[model samples]
Target: MILPEIKREGERYFLSSFKLPDKLTFAGQPIPLDNWQVRERIEYEFYQFLEDQGESIILAKRTGRCFPPAEKQLADAGLPDDLKYMLLVESKCVAAAYSKAKASGPWQFIPSTGRRYRLKSDAVRDDRRNLEMSTEAAVKYLRYLKDFEQNDWFMAMASYNAGEERVRRLLKDQNITDYWKMHGPRETMRYVPRIIAAKEIYSQPEKYLGLSKKDLYMPMETETVTVNVKDSKRALASIAEEFGTYFLELKMLNPEFKKDVLPRGTYQMKVPRQTCPSRCFKQDKTP
Candidate 1:
């Protein structure tokens, strides 16, 4: 059988010649793999796995869309770079994303968990889904779990996903502390690998992944804008229009605001770095 030739180009390596894998079968079912479908499926899954391995790099490139501030906050909080990918895996960096179980945000904190972490969830606001607040809360909880698990990030991460109590029980029952050696649900098994994948991709973007420089969105610089606009969505739209930009740009900048409204009291707004210096105000200065 003729094998595909692997060639290196600049920082990236490609398989010049290759053979498609034999059709996979499970039970009595034969998997379908039409030409275009097979190519799309393989590319999708491959990139997904690549993003999982190198999430930091991938996420940083798409920072504007995915809450780049969270990444900076995590680093400032002294957390591992890999931990940033947890948010990516949980909510795809969308603060408003909600799960069927009521878990929400980048951290995927359930109501109980949010309460435990002192994240407020009321009519005025739901900190559980707030990117900044939830990120801080997640950092605190992860730190607590890390201490309890003896600084085992794997166990701490699993605890974050499955719950501390459950993780503790599993550890006790299995009489094991090594996450790699522990047996649990399939998700748990893939969780660490996913994180690792993201880290790898982020570290060496051009090496393992296929992304163009233009496709990568650089991190935007932003400052807090406290405007007393009851309807955040409308207010953001107004601001975007005032600035001659898109509303989605505003939404991307401020992910914590749930609903279409920014509640009463001062709300934080992030304007692009380019616009920040020109628009940001000091104590006595006006934008």
Candidate 2:
């Protein structure tokens, strides 16, 4: 589908004075304009709800964690730097965060979508909530969307929030290619802006919002240990005592363990950087 340029009239909106194809399809599926109405309405309402909740502050806190690796991933995917802030809104930078919709990890990917991206979600190990693993998957998915949707970051992100099929249909119905000009639902309209607001706060935290410099959560540095134990809690307790640190610290460091139990097999456990020097796991007993 070809999108028309949008223009603003005196206190009103007008579609670009161009004609477009009547039908559009993405990935071989027909974009149903009628079905997109529900999605558009819901998206708009969600955007308004976030706006009323002081989205700027939430975005600021979320974007502060765009470290070099994540930044590089965004660049490699051909996505805008502002798109990184979507992670803040989606999962609050918490790798272990899960949604009521069963979306898990920093990207809040659903089980099916996670599987499509090759993110393992099994009884023994859920890579959806693993920081490094999930981030890698997210980058792959983003790159796929960008490639499929003409490299428009807005469409790519909208496709991320709403399914790619849905966004494609909206673009077809609106006869609009530019995300800012496309009229469908409220959420799509505000989705990009919320992300932009988040980027703004992240780029200049003190200027955009009143966040404490010292209170920022810095990323933790740790070493991974391969353990054969089935129960991570027991192993953590044993190791913590050996290292003279609390079990809670170990738990915090390894958020992938959903039930405080590592699945039976070889599991990757993260230990503090300082603990590596002491060889905490090799010690005999808890301190």
Candidate 3:
């Protein structure tokens, strides 16, 4: 994953030549490759992805663990598979990732939007950090955006990055259904292209970097158990002890818990498979 060297003669750095595919489709919509501006923008981001070898390799590795469940969710929801790539562009698949805009998780959901999609954020827990919960919310939100934008995936995704209200106004004011033609904030403009670029590089990592199956991270196998802490707050260390594990292991599985002591509630928690003793076992769960 060595960084591609940029050539410099005196003051200017020369970018290495990289070519785009003759035909490209994003979210089943044909990219207007004939349009020079569109081609240039996508190619710019493509080269940006290619040159940043370290980031590309990390994304390649993360795909093994992060992409499967989300892709299955998208398929089950009847959404385009490419929509999963938004997670990569949004948070680079980091579960604990947070943005300056207060967006959090792999799907980069802000607090309000997370609530709208049934992802709760309280003092004890931020469900936005849970991959399954957040992905479910993202799938629902993207479906809403797609319907709102009249089945245009790019416009739907643009709305995902920029607020839907802003994209709605841009559509009406500009009178353009085509996302390529709309002029909005710089980040919104680049957002879809960045996802497209990510999709391209991720789809064919061997073309850009050296990687193997062993280098990629596989998802951990875990079992879920329900713990009801009725009318009393409990420290995570004590809870971990109940499962014959440690505080760090419990935290790794349940990053949503904000602190060591969680408020009284029934929690469905993940722990290493077979870690719980027979005395504690009642129902079996998988993750």
Candidate 4:
């Protein structure tokens, strides 16, 4: 077997001589590589991943940790397990991620789209940063898009980055159904390909990014607590202290607390797991 080759200059080592995998699919839908453009676009995405090896490696490390809940939710919904890669491509697994377009959270939902998916985002609270809620909303949106696009997952994915109307227009006006064959805005064009490339690299981190299984960051299980706040920050602090976790650490767990406070009204949030050493550390008296 001929292994992929790598070469190093004084400053940089480049990955090359790696043939594209014999087969690539996204969301259980086979990528139509028979089309030269489809093959090129997907291969272009592969090289793009290789080009940002450091960042891609970091994202790969994170994917293991971030993907479990997504996989679980999709599995529960009977959706494709591979859709988790789309989350990674969207925000690199950062729950509090924000884009200049005002898209927020791990799923990178803009306000209107977030609202369409029943995600609330405002000055006081943004469920977009709530990992579980955002993932659930995204799954619903993707499911709807796929169904709208006649069960073509890639087209649905492109529709996600673009929008349903634009995708519909392209499909109708261009007299074509294939994403690779249609002309879309640059960002939308690159979206699904990036997702596909991410799935490939993350699935074979050892082969692609040279990361070992042990190096992968897996999700840390956490417990949830529902707390209601009315008085002030003191109320939340008290809850955190009771859980044997610091307020700052609690905020890390729940970034939806834009001001270190819970969303208005009844909302259940993940607090701290006393069983987990990392989550249940003693508070510093000095502070």
Tens-digit lDDT track of model 4 for 166-209: 88998899999777788989899888888888788788988877
Listed in order, each prediction's TM-score against the native is 0.67, 0.70, 0.88, 0.86
lDDT (Cα, 0-100) at 81 in candidate 3: 91
Measured over all alpha carbons after superposition, the RMSD of each candidate to the real structure, in angstroms, is: 9.8, 10.9, 5.3, 4.5
On residues 22-136, what C-alpha lDDT tens digit does candidate 1 reach at each position? 4632212233444554334444443555434355445656644454656677688786655776776677676788999899777899999899889878765677766778888
Better of 2 and 3 by lDDT: 3
The lDDT for every candidate, in the order shown, is 0.62, 0.62, 0.85, 0.80
Candidate whose lDDT is highest:
3
* Candidate 2 lDDT by residue in tens digits, 27-127: 23333434465345433433343343355455455454434457777677665555566776677677778877799988889999999889888765677
* Clashes by residue pair, model 2: 40-185, 43-187, 44-186, 44-187, 232-262, 241-286, 241-287
- Give every collision pair in model 4: none
Ranking by TM-score: 3, 4, 2, 1
Model 1 / residue 232 / CA error / Å: 14
- For model 4, the superposed segments whose C-alpha errors exceed 4 Å read 1-13, 232-239, 261-267, 276-287
Across 140-190, the per-residue lDDT of candidate 3 in tens digits comes to: 999899888899999999999999999989989999878999999999999
**lDDT measured at residue 220 in model 3 versus the true structure, 0 to 100:** 82
Which candidate should be chosen as best, given TM-score against the real structure? 3
Error of 2 at 183 (Å): 3.4
Worst 10 residues of 1 by lDDT: 24-33
